[model samples]
Target: MCHIMHIFLNIKFFTLVDFCNAISYEHVKLLSILKLHNVKFFQFFTRFYQYHQGGGFVCVTTARVCSLLQYLFIVLFSTFLVECVDYPVLFNNKNTTADGIPITGKRHIQLMTLIFVLGIDDDNLGNLTWCEVLALLCQKLPDLHVIITKDKLNELDICQRILRFKNYFVALVNKDMLPPVVNIPFLGPQPYLSSGLKLNLDFLFFWGSFSPWEGPYTLKDEYKDPQNIGKLSNSFVCINTQCHKFFIYTINSCIPSVIHFFLLCGAYKKRSNTKLRHFNELDHQLQIRLSRSYDFATRYMNLFTSPLIEIIAKSLKFVTGSIFAVLFALAAWDEDVLTVNLEHALTLMTATFLIVIVCSSMITSDDCVYMPERLMRSIIACIHYAPISWEGKAHTRAVRKEFDSLYPLTFRYILEELFSPLITPFILFFWVRPRMQKFVEFFIRFTVSIEGLGDVCSFAQMDIAKHGDEKCIFILAIDGVAFDKDEDYIANDGKTEISLLNFAAMNPLWEPPPLAAEFINDLKTHVSCLSVFLILFEHILKNVW
Candidate 1:
């Protein structure tokens, strides 16, 4: 009967006639892309219900759980593939020298010059051929260190090779081998920066926010004594090369002497270079202490410094006082209401427990911030400043629901999830099921089939002609690419181009299509010439100005 029902539904929904029944091709396409269908629709609602309650340890049937775990394992294994796991093997090449070859200073300088002239940035390091990379790595420049051994390099796939190069680049930076204006790129977008969230670091120190350190402190005389050596275990002693040899103070110390030392060292200022230098110079004990202190200060200092902190404290006190007052009122009643109606006492207790849960959730939901004000402020900020790129009532509602669903699996979260089943069905029917047509249309419109790959999203296919933007034409032209504007479509932000390059870079042996090969050549040529042009431009500007 189940098999019959499935076959009937497949015939009804998956037929060409059923697809043509939609209002228009465009409408159908939009709907298919946006809405869920078949098994995916069921999965969406299942996840919706799970998240709606508060995400927990997701449990599934034995049959389905294996499939779910299989996907999860794939994700984890993909990350592992990027890591350096292979043993190093020596490369035997007459064209490329072995690692750690003794070379003259002139040859070393030549190698450095070659690298600098190449203008290869970390992001595009993968674009180079394996031979080119291997040649550079094999040279074993005295300054630029390589962590992956020759054996590992010989066996590594493209992804691992790129990762190894990035690691090498980082090592160069750490050793101050790279010249000025060269810096490591932050791989992904930063939440605080992108979201426009302000962390008032200046106000923290500038507003006379200092409090007298209540922690243990030792005088210079006491620290000098051999008798008081054991007492120094609880203390942090930092040496100031500019001033005294060492000063003993605990974490959170704001004593005048410590403050004076901080000012002289310029440690109070938000300078990464200065801080890094000072941090490195510190003794092991002081280094550990400073690290802990900095972390603690950055995370929780706002809680203490904010004027609104007092309000939260007072509000909690007021709620506790009110609860006690209610209990007192019941105790002082002339009539024995509690005895007459014992259920009332039980109801009151239950209500209080719920209130406590709600308050605890507010406190602990966001990384144990324990600040209701902060949570409220964050929500308000999000509402006001969230990107409206996907503007629409439906989109907004969906986004808001998604944001609200994110919570740690605490007692309150568990309770919410437990009760979610009661309302999930109603929500699915009224809110989700009505939009089934949209999901169907969306999938129908955006999905494409490639030989051997079966079905995939059109976007994943990277069809430059369909989705490409014309605005990128000049940018491509600037890179020395000679292409017919009428024939070739320049991908928006060169995403398709970059994606292809990345794929080719990762799979060194994989031969690209003729068009793809031409595109890659153009891109590489552009990159090489662009770097030289930039250098010349910089030089000209410097001389002219």
Candidate 2:
């Protein structure tokens, strides 16, 4: 390096002399002066070039070389140290920026892009959950630019967090291999492909066909080594465009340690199949450590396993405590869900006999009550075990269900369940087969109403059924068809009417009277038992309402 500097310095000296036409002896004297005082050599050379302008061939040859040296220095320094080019703004995420382009399709580039997180079903995840990592990522990155975020990171908070980004992109992987496989049966070709990521970025880096369910982020398996099975790309974070050099990495091959730090903490998903579950339960100790840094892959393999150890411990406690609680409670609890010790065995026997006598007398006393003995048995059993009941510690099944309820219910899971069959059976069936919901809803309401009476939905259904297979009375167009018109029939018994405009097709959007035929047949077949439902319902409503 010093020699290179010297050559350039000498070139400067000769160029001044020759450009000014200095003498050869003058050049020799200047060279000597440069040798004596290296500190002032440049100044001396300049002054000598100005004062002695008759060096002939000596000054001219050296002057040209000096000029060449100056250009060479400019080129080398710019390539190595300074910005090779300037780009004031970053543009690549298409959703946020018009300049955004699909980048992950480029294999070499994808390999060069670091895998921030690999959401496998359940292998290396040590102690933490991907959900918590996602929360942290949002807290840190705060932008919709990455795939796993809740909203666009461009919001003020996210904008501030984004300033911390040393890179242009962050990939968030959603591990679909988690437990409790809940696949929608109806969505055949068009499953509700979960969009794994949500982001607001100028450029998006994606590799696979990226189903709407897959990501705002990219994936690892989506871009394998082509020849190998699970080979990964270690040289990620280098696939940046030349323009990103100005804004992201100050040098090639320099991925900010922040990404790997996140990878270490975020890789602990319970299972990759966590389609709609929140997985953020890290152990107390590791969580404290993780909160300290956003870039921590420097710790090596320990980084991957530290959380795993804690998870194993917590999980052991979870499983054993849960299993034990269920077994103990079930063994201890009696039919009334009352705890019973050996001393209370006689008391339990007496209570059972008295209850049986009372129930038997009630059953035999009334013909209506006796008629629905099986249903009465069901009601009695329900009294023995209830959904919301928590009074007794002896109900093992209840204890088992509440095992993990010690933690606050995850809002994400709640939301997912809301869209599922947890509450509205009709909602689930509606997506695949609407006809099924009509009958199912009618059955529930019918069984529940008992007295052959029900609220609006049930009444609406009964009215529709009574008008069996009838065309909608509301379709009163000029081309309207009247009810009971055999000319425009829809259902099996041929009682319902169809519209003239519709020709022969029935209006599927609006069901034929609620539960047109199947519901009627099922209800009639079970009416002897169903009448008891009415009696029970009337019994309850009369006393309660």
lDDT winner: 1
Tens-place lDDT digits, model 1, residues 214-264: 111111333233455433322211111111211111112223223233233
TM-score of each: 0.26, 0.15
Task: Provide the global lDDT of candidate 2 against the true structure.
Answer: 0.28
Tell how far residue 528 is off in model 1, in angstroms. Answer: 7.5
What's the C-alpha lDDT at position 512 in model 2? 31
* Candidate 2 minimal-lDDT segment of 10 residues: 164-173
Off by over 4 Å in 2: 1-208, 212-394, 397-509, 512-545
| Residue-by-residue lDDT tens digits, candidate 2, 1-545 | 12111111211333332222222334434544444232232233233322133232344445666766765665566574456322333332333323435536432311111112222112233343433333443343322122221333212122112111111111011211111123446722212211111111122122223211122221233232243322212211222222332232222112212222223223332212211111121123223323332121111111122345445545554554454455446556654333433445445445544544433322212222212223322322211111233323322434323322221123333333233323222222233122322222222222212111111111112233233343333321112223444421122221122111111111112223233333333333444454678799999999998
Error of model 1, residue 362, in angstroms: 7.7
* N/CA/C clash count, model 1: 20
